[model samples]
Target: MHRTPTRRQIQAKLSTMPPQRSQATAYLNAYKMMLEKERLEEELDKLEVRRHQIQQRLAILNSQTIPEGDMTHQQANTNLEDNTPKFKTLTLEY
Candidate 1:
């Protein structure tokens, strides 16, 4: 986002700066970087929320087994039992 300098900022830089740093380029760059940092932190927060939702969905699916009347119930149950423990261990670790 390109931002035009506010009146206060321009006044502060033009009239109140010390002789050695008269240009104020460093201060302006620092402000820009601060804005960029805020944008990235917001993005990270959104990604974390999505990741948590996916993990919860995985846990719910892991807890279910095929019904007893299904043709492949035995095979499905064995697969679920084998994989569910791994998911549980990972869930606890996280």
Candidate 2:
């Protein structure tokens, strides 16, 4: 029984071909471009994953409260101080 050649076998045959043939040059160029495209796609996938992680981290930070340790003593004291109005009320006669 005869079996069809695999993709790797076809690629091997193309690689060993002399550069003098225009058809071989085209095939080689195509092969190189395909490899480069695959590499770029993989890099894009990595960057997408990193972007998602950063977004998740941002969401988590937004949902949580700021710890006291992250604030200066003055800031902590200011927040703890009373925020009630201290201005005297002026009565205006109509």
Candidate 3:
């Protein structure tokens, strides 16, 4: 004759099952990594927005036209001279 397991016996058997230690550890690590990735992505997005704003400001400044009465020919010539590049030539004879 066989007897059915009582409530206490069933509870004891369930308690004896192995804990999912490795699986739990892996899940926690993955969750931390995901959070770090999200934070970095948000930081990158903020930097991109700042870059766009700076570029727009630069474009506006570059496109502004100087009034003819305000700029003198001598000043323009000075500006050109300052911006002109000086080149040196190196000749190699082998």
RMSD of each: 17.8, 14.4, 22.9
Residue 47 Cα positional deviation in candidate 1, in Å, after optimal superposition: 0.7
Candidate 2 residues 1-94, lDDT tens each?
Answer: 9898766522322456556758977897888889877887999999999999999999888666355445666686886796777798999998
Which residue pairs collide in model 3, if any? none
lDDT of 2 at 44: 90
User: Which candidate do you rate higher for lDDT, 1 or 2?
Assistant: 2
Local distance difference test, each candidate: 0.69, 0.75, 0.72
Superposed Cα deviation of residue 66, candidate 1 (Å):
6.4
The CA lDDT at 65 in model 2 is 36
Q: How far is candidate 2 from the true structure (C-alpha RMSD, Å)?
A: 14.4
Return the lDDT, model 1, position 90.
Answer: 33
Error of 1 at 90 (Å): 57
Question: Candidate 1 lDDT (Cα, whole model)?
Answer: 0.69
Best by TM-score: 2
| Backbone collisions counted per model | 0, 0, 0
CA shift of 43, model 3, Å = 0.6
TM-score of each: 0.46, 0.50, 0.48
